[model samples]
Target: MLDKHQAVQSHQKKSSRQKLAKVLLATLPMLTVLGATAGLSSCGFQLRGYDTPMLFDIAKTAVIIEDNRTAFPLKLPLTRRLEALGLDVIDNMTLADIANNSNNVGADPIAAITVNNIRFKRYELVGVLTEIRLVLSADVSYQTIENGKPVTLSNPIQVERSYQYNEASVSTDDQQGNQIRDWLYDTLARRITDQYVAISLPKVAPASANKSSQTLKSPEKTTVIVPSS
Candidate 1:
């Protein structure tokens, strides 16, 4: 009876895993297209010989944590990575500062990298040798300002990473945890930087009625017009 119960449990877990895998597979195509469009529109089609690597097509940018209550440490690493890619990092900007910077004359419109959510998950496997799995996931979006109005990217970046370790090693658990955190931070930052390369800056004038008073429209189903081979 115990053996039968264990087999049933194992089958249930396998079915759950398969279902999750299918969902991920279905979303992969959409995510791929969106990221490609982001890099091209934001970076102005580097494939055509443009030589700039800044993700937002803007002179200055700042990273903001949308929810400060979470105590997540992703902002600093992401900022450093963005700067390394040639973006002008404006430090010490508060959410209030970002809101108030709109529509000012000669003011460099500040683009923002906003992180919306962060989550951690853990799974423990029981066997002859027990194992543990850890996952870190974050949802992020970018906003570009044109003529002082904000246009947010429709497709947000979702980054996830998983790590596994032996459950018996209680002595090294703390060290392993720290290592996983750092690894997750690095991976998150790296993927964010990479995706930004495809984005293009909004046109400076932004086609307003008065030329100066016009607001930019945020794209919903942004598509890339790829050249035919």
Candidate 2:
């Protein structure tokens, strides 16, 4: 009878120990979470900014075809946008430079672009060239290094924008035109970057590897729609 009572007591003690251990084990995670929360709140730290470099194949070269005519304002904005996105822009390099120049005879290139046209249509005041209509067009040619060879990937991205002006609101016209151009440049930049990275970069190893939702970034320049002048 005594032995039975002792065994029962022993089992009860064992069960109590197990329950306490489980409670402790569960408390550990909660304690850890609380500690992290406390530490963050105490520090008062805040996230400021982020960086996302443009993705490309391991090693791909790029060249930009320069626009000779300086009368139009397109290439500069486009080039700036590309550079900001961390692309290897082939500046001061021409199609003749690639084809005619012996230096670029054999190169593993990624992409190239030429500003086919950047014109300002003169919307005349009573048949006079008074108001300017801004239009920008480009031809994008891309190639990728595949199995030790350069494969041509021709993807032309063309965008046109126009603005009507009133002599009374010259400042407004200038501001509106700039905003429109900036937006167009940013859109084109992203399109080209995605294409280049998808084609050139390895599928498994993407340029942007972070799975976080914060990878994609908004353009630096914001466009505010202005009332037509």
Candidate 3:
């Protein structure tokens, strides 16, 4: 009778081990998925937000407008965005001071000059003045005073924006146009910041820096008006 009871206890232990193995096998896939999700979260996977990081090198910057007629509308929005990036914005910087850094007395500051041109063209659809196409072209350049000499960090970076006309409601069309304008402003500002980050930032590790350097390129040139001192 004792031998029979010992055999029964051994069989029960084997049965318990088999049950636990089945349970672990069933949950293995879920555990793997959870682990992968946690790993991605730790590797900088994030939902996009408005407060994106600014990784530019310079601390203080001045925005100078060459054409007030076309670029004036964007001034306030650009200044606000630059300030949001924790930059020291100098409102009184002139275009002459940007091109030639002779007049800057104390610590030299970086300068950005924006020249804009806007045009509207009317389109006739089936013999009716149905749509208007508004085109805004902007050119932004950057200059910095390094060691008592002016250096052109970036040439004129051109950004163009346009949208189709909606003639259904006057107010709605106006609002849409304003929205597009705001989007263009934001896009231009982002492009400028990206360019600065690409050129100025020091090289990091081989893998990450190489990936970032691929999206960067040089800018072009444009004429700018000199503001009175």
Best lDDT among the predictions, by candidate number: 1
| Model 3 pairs whose backbones collide | none
lDDT of each: 0.65, 0.54, 0.58
Score residue 141 of candidate 3 by CA lDDT.
60
lDDT of 2 by residue, 54-116 (tens): 244433244454445532344555555445444556666666554444346464444555444
**For every model shown, what is its TM-score relative to the native structure?**
0.56, 0.43, 0.49
Estimate the TM-score for candidate 3.
0.49
lDDT (Cα, tens digit) per residue for candidate 3, span 1-229 = 9999999999999999999999999999999977755554334222233122334445667777655555666677667655554566777777766545545566455655444443323333432334434445555566654454556653555455544554654555467567766676666667766565455443334544544555455334568999999
Q: Point out the worst 10-residue segment of candidate 1 by lDDT.
A: 202-211
Can you tell me which runs of candidate 1 are displaced by over 4 Å? 1-56, 66-71, 146-149, 154-164, 170-174, 201-229
Top candidate when judged by TM-score against the true structure? 1
lDDT agreement of model 3 with the native? 0.58
